[model samples]
Target: MESNQTNRALIKATVIALSVAVVTLVLFILPAEYDIDPTGVGKKLGLTVFNQDGESPSAKTSTDGDQDTVVVTVPAGKGIEYKLSMMESQQVTYEWQTSNGELYVDLHGEPDGDNTGYFKSYTVATVESMKGSFVVPFNGSHGWYWKNNTDKDIDVQLIFSGEYIVEGLK
Candidate 1:
């Protein structure tokens, strides 16, 4: 009879522990750590903005500065250049559009010590507008070179955000 009572007590304790663990996982671990809040509790707590890696979507995680938005013009048959100094693994969001017509764009990056004109190109296209994000692969200046491909003057409006230095934008 004593053995039966002891077995029952142990079983009850085990059940309670498992229940607590499930509750904790559903309420806290799922939402705060993995951004997988099925119960909506994590969203209510303002934790859903974080990713599964515990990183917020708009977090400035490096030496980059605040968001920057700049608008410039590329005269007919003329071109312009702009870039941001960024470190490896840093992230930035970018969106740009031409007011009138199309612009030939070259999005590329050059390493800090590269003086041989060696650069990596992210994209080369004739686009009226674009929006995207990038994770910097190496410490470098990354940006765009736009040439007005239209007959009349064109205005290129660029809007950007993230961890980057806009000290040298032209």
Candidate 2:
């Protein structure tokens, strides 16, 4: 009879441990690491910054500022935008270059509250590479729009440092 009681207690303890592990994984681990927040808690906690490619849109914080390097792919005859969030008077220095050909590029900013389809263009041109620094005039998102007018896809490598948060590819 004592042996039977001992076996039952051990079995109960094992089951309890497994149950706690599963709950923790479903609630915290999956969302924080893999961006698989089934309960939407990870996004609310600002933890789901990684895309499918395992690249995070959030910048790496440093003593001087935030910095990041991102590679964006523009499909043939398509366009894409990479943006960063910044406050008024914040500054950033950036450089981007294409792998092969020139792209129609637009460096611009959109204000934080005006939603009348308005954006302020700082520069527009077709180029293979560009390097510049910008001080935002208002609290808003600032970045580049690259349009590839070719038959093959092109990759653009962008490196930037600033006091900003990356908004990712749009």
* Highest-scoring model, TM-score: 2
In order of appearance, the predictions have TM-scores of 0.60, 0.66
Q: How well is each residue in 1-170 modelled by candidate 2, as lDDT tens digits?
A: 99999999999999999999988887777876666889887777655543434555554333576567888888799888888888888888889999999999999999998889899898899999999998989999899999999999899999999778777765
Report how far off residue 23 is in candidate 1 (Å): 76
Off by over 4 Å in 2: 1-50, 53-66
Question: Which window of ten consecutive residues has the lowest lDDT sum in model 2?
Answer: 46-55
Error of 1 at 161 (Å): 0.7
Candidate that would win on lDDT: 2
Residues 75-157, candidate 1: write the lDDT tens digits: 79978677778889888788999888889999888999999999988889998999998888899889999988667988778
* Candidate 1: pairs in clash: none
In candidate 2, the residue pairs with backbone N, CA or C atoms under 3 Å apart (3 or more residues apart, or in different chains) clash, namely none
Model 2: what TM-score? 0.66
Off by over 4 Å in 1: 1-66
Per-residue lDDT value at 138 in model 1: 95
